[model samples]
Target chain A: MNTYIEGILILAGINLMAVLGLSLLTGFTGLFSFGHAGFMAIGGYTSAMLTVKFHWPFIPALLVGGLVAALFSAIIGKVTLNLKGDYFCIATLGFGEAIRLILDNVQYFGGARGWPGIPNYTNLWNVLGINLVAVLVLANLIRSRHGRNMIAIREEELASQIVGINVFKHKITSLMISASYAGIAGGLMAHYMTFLQPKMFSLVKSTELTIIVIFGGLGSISGSVLGALVLTALPEVLRSFSQWRLVCYGLAVIIIMISRPEGLLGGYELTPSSMKKLYNRLRLKKQAGKQGLEGGDIQ
Target chain B: MNILELSGLTKKFGGLTAVGNVDFKVKKDSITGLIGPNGAGKTTIFNLITGVYKVSEGKVIFCNKNITNKEPYQIAEIGITRTFQNIRLFKRLSVYENVLIACHKNASYSILDSILMMPKYKREEKQLKLQANELLEIMGLSDRRELIANNLPYGLQRRLEIARALALKPQLLLLDEPAAGMNPDETEQLMLLIDDVRKKFQLTVLIIEHHMDLVMGICEEIMVLNFGCKLAEGTPYDIQNNPKVIEAYLGVEG
Candidate 1:
């Protein structure tokens, strides 16, 4: 593939990594977060420091970055996960902004001036490999008992508790896993761009991730994959329109939201079984139509 | 012997007392009825026993353990589970999944085991699935196992809630209005189902109901609550004849 297409694909892969985590938190666990970009920033700076200052290997550094993000998320979740509904959303927004401002003041990582000379380790193949692993791990987690508990919490938190689910612990677990994904995504982006800036992990980036999750459909991994790909590529595809690009992007999002409010997939998975079910239903409809035609001829 | 006891249990929301010094005992393996008028704090009492609300005063002892003010999940873990008056089934999930989720307590596989699909995870999951299916079968929901919970009829939804609660394998089941939206025929079926479940599961049940016929038909002992206080506690005949209970329900001769 050409470099331009490869670059976009790599970018889409990174977005997918973050979007998948957010999907688990928001879609399955029913907790909305705006601080995920903060997690990415932590991962990006941590991994970049490891590579640039300590001469660590790329993969290990990325894993450490994810771990650090998970740690931060655990602490944040401990404090804010108790807040209900919109209050929790606001807390996460505050957290994301707080991380950005803290990074702005920290001079060791180049502070407000931004960090440069980061080695480029992110490639299409590695991005693909990491994302493949991410998807597998997520899919496995979602199918497990733990995953059901998270979904239960999402569906009815009080009922989940009544059914013996530890709601607080599950929420924290979801947040930690989600943050680590964001952290890994951040590490990848740092290496790909070979530069870092606190501004790159701003609230807009967080909102963009959330918008993609909503666009894809809540509670569907395949939807998240399609969403991250389409949404990440849509802006780049609109680049030829220059200054009008954002306007068109916003308009397209609004149109999709209005027409398909439940989202593109609407919590439906695109698995083989579901696809087979759809095919069978369509065939049955065709058979019914043929019977109706035969009856009409008799009449 | 009593399976559960609430002594001087009082819950105050600011100046208002939802349940005031209400004391009761649920006998082991017995179907006890908690009957009262609206806002008479029957559900509030269930909430207190299940640890949904912090007790302002007094103790909740279950199976000879003081379980007052524990977390709801902890209450469930210690062999107590409940259904909501409003039927709080996981609406978007299928009937099988609704029960399966509750059966999670019986499985001890770690998150790592689940993600890696280890032998322990597979074994536990298979067992849990069997348990869920068995519970569904008992609840007469086997045929509709794949249907979304929200799509089920109101009566079935209540049954699903009970099945989900039973999946926890609790010794004591607190049911909040199990026959609320059911017709008389459905309510009759529900009464029999409740009796069957109690016998099969070896359970102690504390039920809150407004349906006089069902309560009178099924309850061995009935506790009446009026303005958050225990007005009467006796067999069905005694509760029916008690003038105080009568006045509490029908009010003093206009």
Candidate 2:
């Protein structure tokens, strides 16, 4: 029972990192990245090979893996972010597949047979510590001036530029940050699983990260955290109806979209004083109108 | 000396010449109006000056430097800011956030310093919040500072757009069709607000507006464009009486 609990923690912590990374890119910056799993592969393979071959320490190996992913992201973002909207998304999807194919066919690092003996060094404490750092750094980044500029760009690029935000530069910086976080997530994941294969970092995994961001509203940091937690737990809770579990999940998604499309948060944010303000506003609306609820502007 | 000088500025969309070799100057510390009916290339001229569209010919001199081909951000960095005709507020961000984002550029904090939360970033961020609140107060939107920008009333949205532009501390401010779709009372209030803002900021203001009363009530000088050419340029009284300007507005397509 303890081992099972540990396994779930490991999965949740690692997935929290990856999905938060996706949230920064697709959710906050509105970049629509589909290459996170590719960066994850870079992190996973690089850290795994370094540890197995060179016998490097865990922390340094993790950093190197993140750097490698960042390098790839910078190159890809430089070319593809200029394409605008869905073009960048599709280009990233291609990039993810290309990375996977290259990894699968490679001569070294065990190729398709996968890399083993990765040494499961990521325990609950390590997982929690790393996830803590990820959340802290992401929260700070979102609150910084760059984060505000990113929100501006995401809302309206032209207005951002007219106010002197170099949109392209900000986009690349954001992509790099997101890529590095994904890389770290992958490294932690590789250690937790004690092995890795090229197939593990697939387009489906990338879609999963994007779905987390979508489940949470874009531009809402708390939404990302909540979305990751719910998604990680919901499947386990539905295991009794094993055959219908995925169907139930799919139905929940549809129902949420059909009923309230802006997402669970509807782009509404939770800052310190906002809780009080929200209560006050809800009370005011209830008193003013005969209706008990209102779907105010989501964006 | 003029604050912004455009010489021989032309724009071409395929074979059609949208704006043809227009020579224009906007002076400092005064409200200038750019007025024309639809299809007169009034908005196109704004687009050219602000670097939204590249000029096919000639130079744009801002504060005595040739900025003909600079990107919009670069132009804005030199202290020229503009608002869109459609009111391009950052819709997803809070009204306060929209203003603070513009304020970030001028705050004296390095990127590394901000990420590390140096005392400077905290101090600046707080100051920026205060400044944003004051600006919102000036625009009568202090109560709605936390509201998502797109949710603001139409008149309040326009004021917020101006507030965001003002956050940049611009020397030259261009407002495109700022009085669009406003009732007479709202337009009158907007006219006073524009004057108040210009006086308070010591700003060189240029507005593209369709409201004749708004233009005549406030603008010291007005430029009328017709078919991509300058039809009239004078004080408000002269513009109201100019034959070509009147004909351009009233007798177009005849």
What are the Cα lDDT values of the candidates? Answer: 0.94, 0.86
Top model number, TM-score: 1
Model 1 misplaced stretches (Cα beyond 4 Å): A297-299
lDDT of 2 at B152: 90
Off by over 4 Å in 2: A266-299, B252-254
Residue pairs whose backbone atoms clash in candidate 2: none
What's each prediction's TM-score? 0.98, 0.92
Residue A145 alpha-carbon offset, candidate 1, angstroms: 0.1
Task: Give lDDT: candidate 2, residue A131.
Answer: 77
True contacts kept of 2: 0.73
Number of the top DockQ candidate: 1
Residues A41-79 of candidate 1: C-alpha lDDT, one tens digit per residue: 999999999999999999999999999999999999999
Q: Lowest summed-lDDT stretch of 10 residues in model 1 chain A?
A: A290-299
